[model samples]
Target chain A: MNILEVDRVSKQYSGHKALDNVSLSVPEGSVYGLLGPNGAGKTTLIRIINHITAPDSGSVTFDGHALTEADMPHIGYLPEERGLYKKMTVGEQAVFFARLKGLSRSEATVRLREWFDRFGISDWWGRKVEELSKGMAQKVQFIVTVLHRPKLLIFDEPFSGFDPINANLLRDEILRLRDEGSTIIFSTHNMSSVEEICDHITLINRSRNILSGRVDELRSRWADGHYSITFSDADPVTLMEALAPMAGSFSTSADTRGRHTLDLRLLPGATLRDVIARANEASTIHAVNEAVASMNDIFISAVKANGGDTPAPVIS
Target chain B: MSKVSIIIGREYAERVKKKSFIFTTILMPLFMLALMAVPALIVAMGGTETRTVTVVDPDGVVAPQLVDTDNVKFVIATAGTDTVAASADDDATLLFIPQGIVEGDKPLRLVTGKAASMMLENEISSQIERIVEGERMKLYDIDVKSIMAAVESNLSVNTVRTDRDTVGSSTMSYALGFILTFLLYMMLLLYGQMVMTSIIEEKNNRVLEVIVSSVKPTRLMLGKIAGIGLVAVTQIVIWGVLIVGLSAAVMPALLPADVAADITAMNSGAGTLAQSNLDTDLLSALALIADPMYILGIFGILLLFLIGGFLLYAAIYAAIGSAVDNIQDASQLQTVAVLPIILGIVFGMMAATDPVSNISVWTSIIPFTSPMVMMSRIPYGIPTWQIVTSLVVLYATFAACVWVAAKIYRVGIFMYGKKPTFKELIRWARYK
Candidate 1:
């Protein structure tokens, strides 16, 4: 079921379109990834969904109802620019924010304690926000965003300040929230995190949606259908000559330790078995593995295919 | 149930809990006591008996009648040319009564260290006159005591006026007026800034966004103004209570009995003056408080003006806070908000010089200035109709300010990055 629908929302600042005819929907109980390069209008879309700025022309629907000012209470938004009162204590600030989100003081206190203890920062209750580290403050903000258990949660660059360990911890909590039936919309440049947690993805470029699908579907769509084959005693000259006509595409190189390895790029409508059968005919294959495209490769390919002039990979 | 109440509660709780509040609450009364006590202590320590002055009569013919008394210690210096310098440093006024003078023509000269005091001069002059009269009486063979007693004293002058009622000195009126105006002006300024700073802090921290999501902008705005206003009111009340309670408790013991009685008489006299001008006294038309009605009236009008004026100005402050992304940007707009308050204070203070003058009337009637001006005039006496008109205009002005402020608020709160100018604010007001 569609929990949020942003239809053709356009925003222009002095004739420069920040968002142009951008339309997307998030399925219920799904971790939707909004993927974009820098300045791809991802933040603009998020701001529109958060009702921070009105679209020039578009309508938003939440839970099958037209969105109104009253719907703000049911949606939690954590902006990329983290804001917390520096002079206020963590506990006081949390309760104040929670109360604004419609939690009573007592309820906020109870929930805040649980979240604080779960995050292992219960001792930070009395500390001012400025006194906390970047990651610690982010943790507090994350807890605040989710404290009231909003039906829809929007997190922008949620893990930007976290170390790997804390990043993994937050990632787990985000997945847990998705599992518990909360629709999540997250926008990030982190392809790895998107690969790890996102179920469905939408890529926006230049104020427009360029590509969107289930993460696996997008990966599969961009897959080259190639396989990597390694053989103990395979001669590269013989293998290349034997498979040259039927290889579709093939390249042989030595591994780091100088062992024989062959990489093949398959043509469209070709199968990995065709290349494997040709390589096996030349020599006995020790190992054969079909390559699956990672989110990074797919992202780069998508960005590149859309006339993006990024630099090729450079070896360090 | 109202959002304003919630805001008020929050503001009261957060502000009253601060250490500064408690500290100021206790410190002010002690400071006031010290101000009153130190002067009295100095005066008491300085009081002493009057100093004595001696007169030396040099002429031997008239020296037999030189009466020495406790207040006047007289020593006769013989009539000689060498005795003048010796008597100059003797802490005495040397009176040289010329020898061989007629009974009625006894001439005298006075000598002292530097200059004799007026008291010493007068005493010496009177004593010389008495000697001359005594000589005249001896020549006529009449009793000198009866002749001296028959001299008439200077006539006294009394004044009576019929055109105007006697009022207290303009100094007291001006003092009360200045004080009342300043108190209102300062409280408004202090709390208005407090409101602005609080809003800016909240906005900077992004807490305002969260708060506004649940509460309407109007409610939130009203709540903030109300909350900070309550805090201001609480502080003022605490200060007032401390001053009044402390004075009532310590004034009797602190002041001398005669001085205290005089002060009480002055207070009662001022009250009677206020009563004498009943038609002009604004307090007489209003419900009288148990305390001095004029003071109560002044305070009541002050509260109304402050609450109304603060709400009006604070809303603008909140709008300014919302419009700017940083404190530096807010400072530029602060001048716009602070200028009217400064004008009110300056003009209101001016009212103290001439409470019944035309300038005071104009200022008191002006809504932008009436809060301070009318407060200043309350001590002297203001007409009921003028008070009502001032209040009506002030309330109307407050409402108008709030409307304009809310317009700015709606646009400014969400605005970031761009600093808006006056033109832009007007444009934003017209945005939808």
Candidate 2:
């Protein structure tokens, strides 16, 4: 079941449309990626879901009912532009936000301490936020965001300030939260991370949702008719010669271990089994796989197809 | 706890723990006292060094009558002694009296190594004039003591209100009114700005979005106002306790033994000491101050006006704080909150002198100025109905203002990049 459903939502600012007829569903217990370029109405959609700002012409449903103020406690949000009060103690600020999310003071303290311990930041509880490094502050913000055990959590650009190890740690925590029956809305410009963790995604561009679907399904649907095969102890010339008669284009490269990799783009109506049979006659086949596009390629191509500008893909 | 209370608790605790808050709470009263007392203390402590006036009285008539004062001494010099030709290092002033008949002809010249202060010059000239006048009076046979006695008069005016049988001191009323009114003015401006600064701080911290997601922006705004308002009230309450406690402990030691005894006796037997030989004005002023009922009355009124006035202005300040991106941008919108507070003080001063004036009555009734204007009038014995009406209007207006301000705040906090104008603020209030 969809935990959050935004139907035909639209938001207008003073002189511009922030979100235009944007709609997406966040299924329960799933890691949903809200992807978009800068100023692509992603924040506006998240805000509508959180009820930070009302939609000009749509309704948001949480669980099975229309979202209301009472439902706020059930949702947690870590906005892209987020911070803790610098003068406030770390432990105190976490408890304050937890209480704001409807946790009792003692409950907040107990839960916040557990979360702090889990994050290996128990020693920083007494320190002021200003005294913390950017990575430490990001950890505190993340801990507070999920400390209340909210059913639905929204995180915008959660990994921007973290190093690789910490970002991986955060990504693991988000997946863990999802596995524990929480619906998560992860909004970010980092497509690689989205490909790594997101179960489903909605891509927004130019104030409208341009593409959205299950991550694997979208990748499969956007796949070109390309395949790659690895041959063990095979000569590069033989690998290329093996595919030369297959009525298709072929490229060969050899690894340091002397195993040759041949990339093949089959012409229409060419069967994969036939290609494998042909290659088997000349060389031992180790593996065979279809070439699926990455989310990065899908994102750029989709945005460009919708008349949006993206930097030219660099070839290496 | 409720969201607003949680927010209030944080806001209050965060500021109350600040060193600046504690320092201001303790030092504000001392600072005010210093402002009033420093000049008087400087004047009371006059020049400490004594200077000698070298008297060249050729005829020896003026020298006999010249007397030494605490800070000035007369040193007689013989004729033909040019004191003016003394070394430049000499600090003494030369008082050269020409040898002439009783009829005035030549003036008395005073020469100093350096330029003499106007105070010292006037002192010397006045002293000589008095001496010469006494000499001239001898020729007329006028008794100096009787003439001096007839010229000095001790007059004290007591104010009696025809509306009531009470005879109150106008001076006490004015002093109390102005002091309390000025205090309200300061608190209104100081705490109002505090509310704005904290809001801007939260916005800059980028924490508003995180907190507002869980709580309604209206609740958050009210929570902030209530929290900061509680801080203001806490400071004032601390000050009140300190003032009352310190005066109770220290006033007796500072007062003269007899006056303190008279006060104690007056407390024990009111009419008995009233018939005794203590100054009625001092006794009444002290009695009014020591009256628990009166202090409670003023304190209660001051707190009511303070809360109402603070809520009214703080709502406007909060809206302004949210509308702007930074403090520099806030200055322009701050005039909306500042001008009304300034007008409150202006009307308060007018009320201090004439409590029943039309402008005073209206300003006291208006919510924007009522906190200060009504406080200034309360000490002057304003009607009970006027106080009730003013308080009702002040609180009602506060409710309306917070409602409107909450609307603006809800939109303004989410707005970034552009600083909003007043028209935009009003338009934001119209948003659903």
Candidate 3:
């Protein structure tokens, strides 16, 4: 079941359309990836969902009801631009955010202490935000974001400022939060991380959702009809001679250790069997594999194909 | 707590916990005390200054009855410009009553070695006039009755107001009005700017987005301005109570015993000052100042106007803070908020001098300057309709400012980089 739904939302600024008829459905207890390039209206859509800015036309439903101010407590939003009061102590800010999310003071303190202890940042409670490094401040914001135990957590570039170790820790916590029944909507430029964790994907380009589906489905949908063949005793000339009749294109290269590999794209009527049989006529085949598109490749191609004016800001 | 209250708490706590706030709260009262005490101390020491004057009577007219007091002594010198010049070396002021003195020419030449003192000069002149009067009374022999008849019977008024509460010094009223107007004026400027700085700080740090996401923008603005206002109010009230209390305690110790007794007698309403032989201006000023009712009345006015004036202006200050990306960039916009407050102060100063004049009446009834102008006029007992009209106008203006400011603030706080023009801010009010 989808926990949050944005329906036909459109928003316009003074001279620009920030979002145009955009829609998305975030399922319960699953990680959903919101993909977009720079100025493709991702931030604007996220802001609308958070109710920081209302959509000029459209409705947002949470769980089964129209979203309202009272529903804010059930939704945790960590904006792409992270900030905290510089002069405020970490603990006080934590409790204050919790209270703003409708937690009682005692409940906030207890939960905050547990989160701080779990993150090994209990020492930061007394430190002012300006005294902390950017990574440490991001951690505080992360803790504040999830401390309310929200049902729907929208994190925009949550891993921007973390070291690998801390990144892994946060990744683990995000997965754990999902496992414990919170639906997550994650937006990032790190395509690898999205591949690792995101189950569902929606790609937006030029203020429109161009492609969306399961992560695996998107990868397969964008895959080129090519196969990578690893073989023994296969010379480039022999393979070219034997496969040129059925193959549309081919490339061959030898590694420094003298292992030869051949790449081939089949003609429209050709099958894997035809390529494999032709390859066998030339040399002993050790292995044959089809090349599936990576998320990064799919993202670039989809954006290019849709004619995006500028590239998305890629973090990794 | 409501979300607005949480924001209010955060805003208030951040400021009150600052070292500057702590130091200002403690140091400002001490500064006021120093200002009040230093002058009173000087007046208490006034009796000890001494001077000597040499009288040179060329006509043999003024020597016999020129008696001297302990602080101001006199010595008779033989008549001449040369003798006066010789005595001048000792720094004794030389007072020359020439033979042609009755003609009012060569006009009572007094010479001294240093810069002249008006008090010492006036003392010598009055003594010479007395001595000359005695000599003339004997020469004329029938002149005492005629001299008495020649004196003009000037009439002076001792006014008692219809309220039967006679704290009777116009200077004291003007002084109290000036003090109260200045205090409210300062609180509004200081606290309104504080709200502006606080807004700009949050904007600069990029924390305003996080805050606005949690609470509505209007609520956030309200909490911020009202919270900082409460802190200013608390500080001013504490200062007022401290000054009043400290003055009550320390003033007696600072003043001489009989002066203290006279002040207490006036405070206690024991005797009408007009009936006393001591007809000094200082005693009347003291009587007016020491009236607890008058002081209390001023205290009440300050409290009323400080909050009202501060909120009236702080709303616009917050809006100005939000309309720009940086504090320095916010300055041009700040002038819009600052002008009315400065006008109010200057108007109050002008209007206190003539509360019943048309300009005072007009300015005091207008909401922008009324917080200050009305307070200045209040001590002079403003008419009820003027006070009511001013309050209604000001309250309405303040409400309207909050409404307009909130509209600008809601959208402006999230805007980055560009410095918005006044027209753009107005447009933002209508934007989604």
Best-matching candidate per lDDT: 2
On residues A54-92, what C-alpha lDDT tens digit does candidate 3 reach at each position? 889989999999988888888898887878988889999
Name model 2 segments beyond 4 Å from true: A224-289, A311-316, B30-128, B134-148, B151-154, B257-292
- DockQ measured for candidate 1: 0.31
Report the lDDT tens digits of candidate 2 across residue range B253-366.
555566666666655544444354555556555555555556677888899889999999999999999888799999999999999999999999999999989999999998
Q: Give model 1's share of reference contacts.
A: 0.34
Instruction: List lDDT for all candidates, in order.
Output: 0.72, 0.83, 0.81
- Model 1, span B1-432: residue lDDT tens: 344565667777888888998898679758855764554444334333333433344445556676654346666554364655564556645566566544446545666655666766676667767777777677889887776579745332211223333334444456667876887887777788787777777776666655554566666777788788788777766766665566566655755564444445444434332323222222221112112434455666767776777776777787777677787887888888788788888878888776778888988888777788887787666678898888888878878877777777766776677788978787767653
Please give the lDDT score at residue A115 for candidate 1: 98
Ranking by DockQ: 2, 3, 1
Q: For model 3, how does the per-residue alpha-carbon lDDT over B222-243 read when each residue is reduced to its tens digit? A: 9998789889877987787777
Which consecutive 10 residues in model 3 chain B have the weakest lDDT in total?
B273-282
Model 2 over residues A1-316: C-alpha lDDT tens digits? 9999999998887778999998888889989999889889988888888888889998999999999888988998999898889988998888888888888889999988888888888999999999999899999999888988889999999888888899889988988888888999999888888888898999999999999899999998877667888987567676676666663667777788767788788777777888888888878888888978888888898999999888343221
CAPRI-style class, candidate 2: medium
Give the alpha carbon lDDT tens digit for every residue of A120-212 in model 1.
999999998889988898899899999989889988888887888998899899888888788999898788888888889998877888788
Q: What is candidate 1's TM-score against the reference?
A: 0.74
After superposing candidate 1, which stretches have Cα over 4 Å from the reference? A13-16, A127-130, A224-291, A300-316, B1-8, B29-167, B208-219, B252-291, B356-360, B365-367, B403-420, B427-432
Model 1, residue A135: what's the lDDT?
88
DockQ of each: 0.31, 0.65, 0.59
